[model samples]
Target: MGNALRFLYGQCCSEPPTTTTTYGGAGDQQLGHHGVSSTSVGVSALAQHLYHFEITSQVPEGLSKHVSSSKKAQSNWYKKLSKAWRESKPPPKTPEEASRLVIRTLQRHQRPDIEVDARAVADGDTVTVYVSTSDAPESSRVPQEVHMAAVERNEARAHKNYTKADALQKQIKDAGYGVLHINNEEILARKYRIRLRGIDAPESAMPYGKEAKDELVKIIDGKCLKILIFDEDQYGRFVGDIYCNGIFVQELMLKKGLAWHYTAYDKRPELEKWEKSARAKRIGLWASSNPEMPWEWRKNRREHR
Candidate 1:
């Protein structure tokens, strides 16, 4: 009995019993021996037990699939959402992109289409972007009208119709205006006197003073001129240069010795040459042995008064 018990114990504890039957007792007892025991199971049964425990204690297949699918859908949704958000934002820092945005906004406003050269815009200032239609009318070009009038006068003078030309001159003088004839078709007239650059013609008729005025009238009587208005003088006359078809009227008068320049008001440094030429030629007031500058003559007259 002791030996039999030891054999049964060895069969159960050894690697595995290779034999199909064990020497227990007989038919019923043999059935008992064949019954299932913990140590006597096959490899398939052991694998099934491990699989069952894993299913119960660990994660399920259905739950893991659902979780992975949810994560993937969330990642895709976030990518699309970020892309849509970026579309409405301001442009990047590049100059070309920024300029395009500015120009588009400006075009929406009704402003002038003046080509803006490259410039930096300040913060908070309103920028102009559109074309404007409020420009001066074509028929209202003042300079062009003056030029045409000058041409008509010149044509009259050229045909030796002195009466008509003289009448025009008188009309111009009476109107407190000067005429500029530009080319044969353009004339300009303004009801103002531009101080002749480099020379001052006297207001009253002194010796050679009327002659100076007459010379100026002859040269610019019916010409078109560009008047650049500077400041006004104490006498309320606008002091500026008269450009006849772009020629400086003052330079021509000075070259002809028709006028003497007032040095205090004439800023041209080159007038010294003209002065020398005038003195050498004995022109205008220079003909007198003691010719007085208009300012000095006025000062002396004031003192005598």
Candidate 2:
């Protein structure tokens, strides 16, 4: 029976080893069993066939169903994730809009407000800006009217009406503003509280420094000075060359020797040449045998102090 069972099991498992068994009694009589036995030993074969049939019939359908469901679930999950990502992202802002937002934020933080208003003057070479506090009264804002006045003055200057032009220039200067004549045709003027450029003068002294200031004043104080703005100093003041009546103030001062060439900041290539010429001619401060450069004087004074 065991051998027959083994044979049946082998056949059920697709081809197995053949088995043969011999039973011997005490009297030396032998009983040999061969071929398949007519016993219930083939149960394992039936069970194995049933198991294989069940798996073959149901496994494909189960796999197909599972794959379809998993595909649908992944599609839905990806759709939801993409939708959420779009909702969470913010739109990009334009440059102008972003600048406005920044300004508003700064204002909210109690920062000082700066406003620029540009107006075209008649001559086409100038623009004017009137600056005033945000809380200033409407009547106190002078930028618009000043720009128009500057345009009128530029027209007058162009026509050689020096008297009228001078009067307007004085009015503008008295109002604490500077007028820029652009290409002798247009005007860009602004009302700004700024110190005079280059030379530092005392309130009262030998009037030498004041004389330098006055010379600058006579040339550029009331007339339309062409401003060549280069850069701003650490103090936020505009470091520029002032051209008065077509004269370079830096060169003028250097020629007269009234002012030493400010080599540290004034980087005009022609400065050294001008200084040499002035020294050879023995002009202004260079008239002295040992006239000290202003920078060296300032340094020495500071060190002594």
Candidate 3:
């Protein structure tokens, strides 16, 4: 099953879009490249076999006709399909119903996007998440065997069966999954460190730094975040925008004056607007006549050291 999903994901990536998106902002912005095309991944036979409908570019009727052959289009389709699949309670009763659902979902998202789950916050602008094998839209469901293995490993450790536990751990790692513990609950997940895009907050020792961290924790703690990854930084942290319950996390921080818009790396007009609003109101760090930038603080600390 793992191999099959990998093969299908490769099929999604094998073809590039006819056109690439250009970012006029600062630094290099890496948008959604990790995407899957539902139309090409064995969807035709499923539609035909189950719905008695032939989905092809030649025939071009129903869902097939509307979907673009481009990779970007397919990626967007998959993101919508993923959201729909999660929201669908009774699931689709028939192939026609499923096809209709796909059509509806495809209409909403026109841009490329990537997604991940947040597990912990390092500060106001950095977080840790787990990206397991199931993060892919093609394989939204985690393999049952992996879950069982995790449970078994825990039992083995409890029983002092170190050898057995080690073997099971190896199996889990080989399958691209890791064992995680959150509030004493054992979880199977992968670790991903992410840096919030377009904003830089104060360091821990800086003014309002603790407040900034606390506010971030308050907003995201125990809540699943929808992260749109843009790029990866030198420290191996993914840089992205975080959305919690449809609220833009970065916007809140900037508007509250907890963070500064890192204009050198990001040129989002909204980020600049939010920061300006906070500054005008003298909120958070903006209350200081001359707040030291986190970058500058880090530089001074380095020089002193």
lDDT of 1 by residue, 1-305 (tens): 11111221222123332333334556433211213232333322222222333345422222211121122222332233223223425422232332343334323432221211112111111011111111233113334333344445555765889988778766654544343322222122334433544466544446666666666655554444555556677765566666656777676666666566668876676666776687798876678887666667678788995
Candidate 3's error at 62, in angstroms? 39
lDDT pick, better of 1 and 2: 1
Q: Whole-model Cα lDDT per candidate?
A: 0.42, 0.41, 0.62
Clashes in model 3: which pairs? 130-190
**Model 1 RMSD, rounded to 1 decimal:** 40.1
Best by TM-score: 3
lDDT of 2: 0.41
* Candidate order by decreasing TM-score: 3, 1, 2
The digit string of per-residue lDDT tens for model 3 on 1-305 reads 22222322333224333333334465654222112123332332332222211122222123222221222223434445555744666544344545555656654532222223333667778887665332245235556667667657866876899999999999887876676543333445655688999999998788888899888988877665788989999998989998878999999999999999999999989999999999999999999999999999999999994
TM value for model 2: 0.35
Evaluate model 1: give its TM-score.
0.38
10 residues in a row with least lDDT, candidate 3: 51-60
Each prediction's TM-score versus the true structure: 0.38, 0.35, 0.54
Pairs that collide in candidate 2 are 125-186, 126-187, 126-188, 127-188
Residue 262, candidate 2: Cα error in Å is 1.7
Residue 258, candidate 3: Cα error in Å is: 0.4
